[model samples]
Target: MSGILETQQLTHIFPNGKAAIQEINLSIKGGEFVIIAGPNGSGKTVLIRHFNGLFLPTKGKVLLEGEPITKDLTEARKKIGLIFQNSDSQIVGQTVADDVAFGPENLNLSRKEVDHRVKESLEAVGLSDLANQQPHTLSGGQKKKLTVAGVLAMNPQIIVFDEPFTGLDYPGVLQVLKQIVGLHKNGHTIILVTHELEKTLAHAGRLIIMEKGRIVRDGEPSQLINEVELYGIRRPYGQNRSVETMTWLS
Candidate 1:
């Protein structure tokens, strides 16, 4: 079956002549929750960046609905909203509402439409009350939610989150995790990248493990959960708990 988004033999080499990712063929169907996990330097970030044309492939190509993403980078990005690991980096406006409106505003949307999107997106992430607050004043978790809101405002069919839980307290993790699961439940295809599988493994339908710039394993999360430790991602299970119980929400 063709994927809503796909990468064929995707490879990327940095200017230093090092291949960050190599021969990564991936297919992501609509409404699927996929987790890409690996230790640091495993090319997880590089791979997702290509999904929306953030970084062009050194080899192969990225397809959105079977058409090259390069053919219309703008449209591809609108369909594939990426929430970066560092939320602060994605922030731009002085206020939370303004920040979320940035993407829609760039699309030349009418003021009413932009306001509508910003309002809906902020509410989706539970940040409606903080719309007038300065972004820099938000907590780590709130900042993450703000980024998600920013992406959500773009009305992307797919959302890619890169190391979303990097630095967050227990409450922060729970907040972000709930938002992610809610997005999936609401019919958004989710592509999440993180080595901390214990926080979200149970929620994912598929798990893809990467090593040395290539995918080493891809299958059902339960089937691959035991093998993640082999690729340097800490196994989220033990004798007492199973993959189904490996979520921060519980």
Candidate 2:
């Protein structure tokens, strides 16, 4: 199967020469939902940034559909959409509808097309009712959904979510997880950067575990999770809860 995205010998370093990513190579297939699992400072965010051209690789290349991603960025970014960890950083316009329309607007799409995409994206995330409200007025969960809607409006082939479940309450986390599953059902290539394993392992087809800036394990989620020591750096959700914990295995 052809990969939708590929990285060859990928590495990143700060100006001070602290390596964040080290000699990584991975191929992400189309229509597959893959999660990058690791503890903080494992370079998960840095890796995703390369996908959208947010951070240039210091040592290797990022290829989109087998070709090197162009430095032009507009074209490269059009193929891969990135939803940031902070919802506030991605939102632009005051109103929800306008904010969601931002990406399509950059594409110079027709007003009708932009409007249609804005409405459809908002509806996909179950935020159609909040379209006219100000982003600042929406709850943290709503803002995250709004940012995701904006990314969806671009209709990119792949979506990279950086720590999406962070800071959300239980209900909010479920909402985001469901939206992610819905996107996968619709056949978008999904790359999720998260420390939370259980939610993603249950949902994603593939799991890549990292340690100290390198991919230490990459395989099916079922197999990877069983190797507890390889993934010990990150803990599963509800580890302290007894009732919901045992139910998952059965």
Candidate 3:
């Protein structure tokens, strides 16, 4: 099967003349749960921003299912969903219902279809009751939930999450984790970027670590747990990483 996403000799330079990422080559398959762990400014965010053509490479190219994503950014985004670290930044609609329906509406789906998706997504995220509430008025955790609901409504095959657990309390984390697992079960490729290994380590099938804007390690979760801390990431606390942790994550 073709990789759902691929980057060929991908290199990116910011306007400041700093190279954000260099020679990134990746083949992310469908329905895989991947975790990207690295320190701040390691180019993890910049790299993923290319998957859906949010940040086109200064050189080389990004491909979605073997087609250049930049050529069809709108269609590429429909297949690859991106959830940023800051939920507040992604929330644009005034009310929760309107926000969740934004993507479907953009797709030009009929009103009945859009409404069905909005209701289903809100219920899935446990935010059905707050459908009419203003997005800016929701609590921090609620905002995060709202953000996920919007992406979920899009029904993308590959979902990229940047620091998914940010601003989430313990219960909130569990809630989000449950939703992530559900997405995985539904066959959506999950590419998660975060430093919090303990919360997500157990569910991830593969782990990739970056340092200084380059991929340093990529392997099964069981094989690389002890090695990530050297690259500014903390190992997950209190886990027997010797055995397969893929099931643990699920």
Best model number under TM-score: 1
Model 3 agreement with the true structure over 180-212: per-residue lDDT tens digits: 888888788999999998877777899999998
What 10-residue stretch in candidate 3 is worst by lDDT?
A: 241-250
Clashing pairs in 2: none
Q: Report every candidate's CA lDDT.
A: 0.93, 0.84, 0.88
Clashes of 1: 0
- Model 1, residue 150: C-alpha shift (Å): 0.7
TM-score of 3: 0.94
Better of 1 and 2 by lDDT: 1
Ranking according to lDDT, highest score first: 1, 3, 2
Error of 2 at 123 (Å): 1.4
TM-scores of all predicted structures: 0.98, 0.92, 0.94
Of 1 and 3, the candidate ahead on TM-score is 1
Model 2, span 1-250: residue lDDT tens: 6588999999999999999999999999999999898877888889889987889999999989888896557877887999999999999997999999988998999999999999899989999998889999988888888988999998889999999988998777877887888888899999998877666667677889887789999988666665645545555645453222422222
Error of 2 at 148 (Å): 0.9
lDDT of 1 by residue, 1-250 (tens): 9999999999999999999999999999999999998889999999999989889999999999999999999999999999999999999999999999999999999999999999999989999999999999999999999999999999999999999988899899999999999999999999999888888888999999999999999999878876777888887757557888777774
Who wins the lDDT comparison? Answer: 1
Candidate 1 segments exceeding 4 Å error: none
